[model samples]
Structure formats: structure tokens, C-alpha cells
Target: MTRYYRALRLQMQPCGISNHAAAWVTTSRLRLTLPTSTSTPPRLQACRNSRSISSIALNRTNPPESASTRSKDGRQQQNGTCAIRPANREFSTPSKVGRIYDPKMAKLWADTPMSLISETGYKERSDIPPGHFAITAAQNMAHLHNVIIRGFNASYNQCLAVKPDTVDASDFLFYNQGLYKSIKSHHDVEEDITFPSLVKLTGVQDIMDKNIQEHKDFDHGLELFRTFVFETDPKSYDGKKLQEIMDIMFPILHTHLVGEIGTLLDLAKYDSKKLEEWWADTSKKARGDLDVFQDAPLMLGCIDSTFRLDGDPRPFPPIPAPIKYLSKYVLEWRYSGRWRFNPCDTFGKPRPLAFPNPGGSKL
Candidate 1:
């Protein structure tokens, strides 16, 4: 019985469907042998589901077509991958181009728009010294410094003229910021280019070096003033604070201007070749450190005359005022053709004019 049951189980194992429909035997009497491939015909195994059966038949008969479809689907999936998307890629080209094309200058002169102040004739030319180019550069530096100084003085006076309590804090801050920005920018250009070049040209490295140091000192004072204006309470206009700010600022400015003027006058004697060489060397060293020179006006208006009014009465008369007045009058007379002879010339020995005080104050 056991042997018969084992044989029945072997017969039921998945082999195939037979063509004969009535080849059955009772389980108690059955005996079966597995068919060898050479002796048995090929058969179809039964699938559990219709879809799986269809897929199996299709795969067997059309392998190349199915493989082609799979390859196409794979390619689309790869293309849709987030890592391959356009938006995911970094924009490196613009930055690279920018670095390549951008001008590496501290200031550009051409970008500064210039307007003609007058259409009249220029001032008379003077004989330049051997190192005239260096001297000219120094003069330009001095002129620019004076221009900024005058601008600061004017701005400060304007601020002072207004009643502090009535003035808008925002307006005052804005004004101070503008003045500071302008002055600081100008000074930076000088320290980075103008003064350094002048030093090289004149070969007065020591003086130039000292000037650079002075710039640091000047900046220190400026920082303090900036802090006082911006960081401190706007309503705090105590006498001590005001005095402190003035005390730190005025002396530094006065000394800087005086020293710069002296240096400029000394530089005026250098030759063109020396100046050119100095410029070349300094420019090479500076590389793109300097900003592009914007042709902004050195000054907006004339300097204040009030600073000169601060001293004791002198024994000698003030010479510059009369000279300035006479010079203008003489030029006007010449232009108008109202003079009979050369008003500038004299027949007697030229003696200094005794300028009598019109106001009878006993001196």
C-alpha cells in the first residue's frame, strides 16, 4: 500500500498534459516512471493566471522586440533622473565669464563724466622744472586734497548753520555719510595711487612713506568722528562731545594739509622721465588695487574764508586780499580797453604798498 501511494504521488508531479484523456489508474494499483527527454514529446505547463501565461508565451516567441522596448524605457528613465536635469546643474559659465571680462581697477577715469566749467582761455603756462611731471602730479594731488578739505568744511558749516534740534537726524546722518564717503574714497585713491606714484617719481620715498603713515593717523581720527556721528545718540549734543569730536578732527586735518602742500611744492622740481618711470613702477605694483578714476569735480565751490579770520591783528597789512582784488580789476580793465597805458607797469622803484587801515583802530 505504501509503495502504491509513493507511485501515485510521483505520477501527480508537474510533467505535462497527455493527448490521451482516459489513461487513469487507481491510486492503490499505480506505478509510474519519470519520462526521459529523448523519449517524451514536449508539453505545456499550466499557469496559475491567464496574464502570466500570456506573458510567458510572448517572451518565448518575441525576445528581441521585448528587449528593444525595455531598452527604450530604460533610456527615458535615465533622462528623467534628477541629477541629469537642466535646473539641477550649476551655472558656472556666467561667473567664469564675469571674472574674465570684468575690469580689475579700483577706479576708472573714463567712467567719470566731465562737464566744461568755462569756455574761456586757460591760465598762463609756467616754465616746468627738470622733474616737472612729478611736480605736476604732486600739484594735482595737493589740489584734490584741498578740494576735499574745502568740501568737508562747507558741509560741516552747512550742518552747523542749521539749528541742531530742528534738523532731521536722518538728514544729518545722510549728509555726514555722503561727505565721509566722498572724502574717504578720495583719500583712498591718493594713498593707493597718487601719493605712492609721487613718492616713486620724486625718489623721496621717505616723505611718501611718512605721508602713508599720516593717512593711517587721519583714518583713525575719521573713524572716531564716524562713531560719534553714527553710533552715539543723535540727541546727545553735549559740549564735551562736540569738543571731543572737533579736538580729534581739526588738528589732524590741518597738519595733513600743511604737510601735503609742502610735499607738493618740493615734488614740482622732478623731470618727466622720472615721473613716467615712477608711474610705471607704481602701477605695475598696484595691479588692479586702485579703483577706476571717476572724473568727479575736486571741489563744488570756493573754500570758506572764515578760518583765516582767527588771529591777533598783525603789524603788517593783509597782502593777499588787495593783490587778489587788483589782479581781477586789472584783468577787467584790460579786457574792456579802459586803461590809457600799461596799468601793471610803474616808472619809479617798485616798493611794497603801505596798506593803510581804513578803520582807525590804534595799532
Candidate 2:
């Protein structure tokens, strides 16, 4: 009698993954084993995809129950809706965005609306859940890409402007530095504060390992972009080099941002009360470590530019009203030269486009 041995495999593409890595602890590794005659090949074919956005390995051992996060009745609750249902484990964003290489065109944002993961009724609900927050966060992350892309397009246009010499490269470099640091702060918060809390709250082991791996995947390009920004003299800014880096970095970022959001539905398992508490605590602590005076101006500049009233998809993190007034009125004037390229005023209101729109359309 002949016997078969089936194996699982994980394949990573040769290009686009990053070089400099944060601490990546691989809890599991894919095995390539010989299969028996009875084993079918279809199973393997079903698993392969570009995004690597599959759900956590469900086969892992689930711990014994601690308490009923559920109501007296066993049904789950989600986003103020009663009798919550299990997320269809197989649910995935309909498109395979990882296959695309350009962030500007990937259209991943089109697929990751907050409503897809949480109850749509939350839009009307006076209160929203953590899962809802994650969905909005995902939308905001995708929007950040557009801000970066717009900045790049503006630079490209400047290079082609009727009189290129009249344009100052140093001023642009200051703008780029501010933009880069803002994104860096956002990601730093995720890796340091948010992911760990989610892992504990969700009660899923190694749940965030893949997210960390994805960070490692794109962080190399980001590091290169950073070096260029800080090392290159603003007086002799290299627009060509800047464009080249943006093209390389955007697609990798798109894949990670959209893919990470797709998994947030899993957080819906925790009760809304628990979810809200975790987010509130985690968010408050996330940025507490940064130097406020030196760092916040640039970060606020970038965040404010991409996200503004009625036009933006989500609200800004709850900054106190007094601080908002001070940041806009008191602190931002120091950086006025660099901020001239920004799409908003110091108070986070939309401003006229500083660079000419090549397609001659509204931003």
C-alpha cells in the first residue's frame, strides 16, 4: 500500500520586499513536503495569492474560555447591533491589490471602506466600535498615500515648469522632510503601541506577526527615502532621485495598508465595550513619547493637509480645541516657508494649490 504526505508552503516574491527589518519573529514556517497519491493539487492552488492577506491560521489551539464577553444569551454584539454573527472567515477584499505595483493606480482605497468590515448602521449609531475605528484608520492610511503622491506630482511639475530655475529646491526639501516625518510617526505608533494591544485584546497568538513582517517588507524603501531627504542638501535637491524613490515606495505601502485593514473584521469578535476601551487607551499612549515642539508641527502639517472637514473620510485624532488653536496660530508660523506647499492652512482648513495642476483639475 502507498501512503501520501501533504505539506504547506509559503512563497515570497523576489522583488519589492524591504531590506532593513525591525524585530521579526517567525513563529511558523511553511513546509514543502512530498504528497501521497491520494492528495489533490487543487488545495495548494487555492492558497496562492499576491496580497498574502489570508486570515490567521484557524487550526491553532484556542484557549479555554475565560468569561462570556457575550451577553446572558450567547450571541455576539457588533457596532451597537445585537446578536452579532461570526465574520465569514473566507471574506476578503474582492480585488487582489498586491498584483499592482503603483500606489497611485492600485485602487486599493476603493475596496477598503469602513462599512465593509463593521455594521453599516454604525454610521447612524451615536457610538462607534473599535472595529469601526480600524476601518476609518484604514481609509485614512490610504488617503495619506494620495497626499504623498500629490506632493510628488507637484515636484514633477515644478521640474517641467516654464522657468525651472525660479523654483527653489531647498523649500521643497523642507516640505518633503515634514511629509516624511509625519508618515514615520504614524507607522512608529502602529509598530510600538497599537499592534501589541490588538494582539492581547483579540486573544490571538502571533496575530500581529504578519503585520510586523509587512512593515519589515516596506521599511527598507522608507529608510532609503529618509536618507535621501535628510542627507541631500536642500540647495541642491535632486527631484529625479525623489521621484524615483516615491515610485518604488508607494505600491509596497498600498499593499500593506489595504491588506492590514482587511483583517480588522477579526477585532469585531471582542465586545464593543472592550474594543472601545482598548482603542482609547492605545491611541492616547501611542504618540506620548515624541518631542512635541520639534516633531508635532510637521506631523500636524501633513495630517491636516490630507484630512479636512466634509471632504475627508475620517475625523482627526481628538486633539484638544485649545491645542489645535495654538498649533495653528502660535507654532506653525516658524515653518511657513516649507508649509507654503501644503494643501491646507495652519488651522487644518483647505488652501489653494501651491503648484500648478498639470491635468488642470481640482485636487
Worst 10 residues of 1 by lDDT: 111-120
Give all TM-scores, in the order shown.
0.39, 0.53
lDDT of 2: 0.44
The lDDT for every candidate, in the order shown, is: 0.35, 0.44
Superposed by TM-score, candidate 2 places the C-alpha of residue 325 at a distance from the truth, in angstroms, of 3.3
Model 2, 196-227: lDDT tens per residue? Answer: 88888887878878878887887888888888
lDDT of 1 by residue, 1-363 (tens): 344333322221111111121122122342334333211123311211343345446553322334343433242111210111111111122221111112322121111111101111112224445435544444434434443544444333233322344324334443444445555655665676666666655566776776677778878778876776666444643324533564577567656655665555455455667666664454334312111011011111222121111121111111233222222232222322111111011111111111111231111
TM-score of 2: 0.53
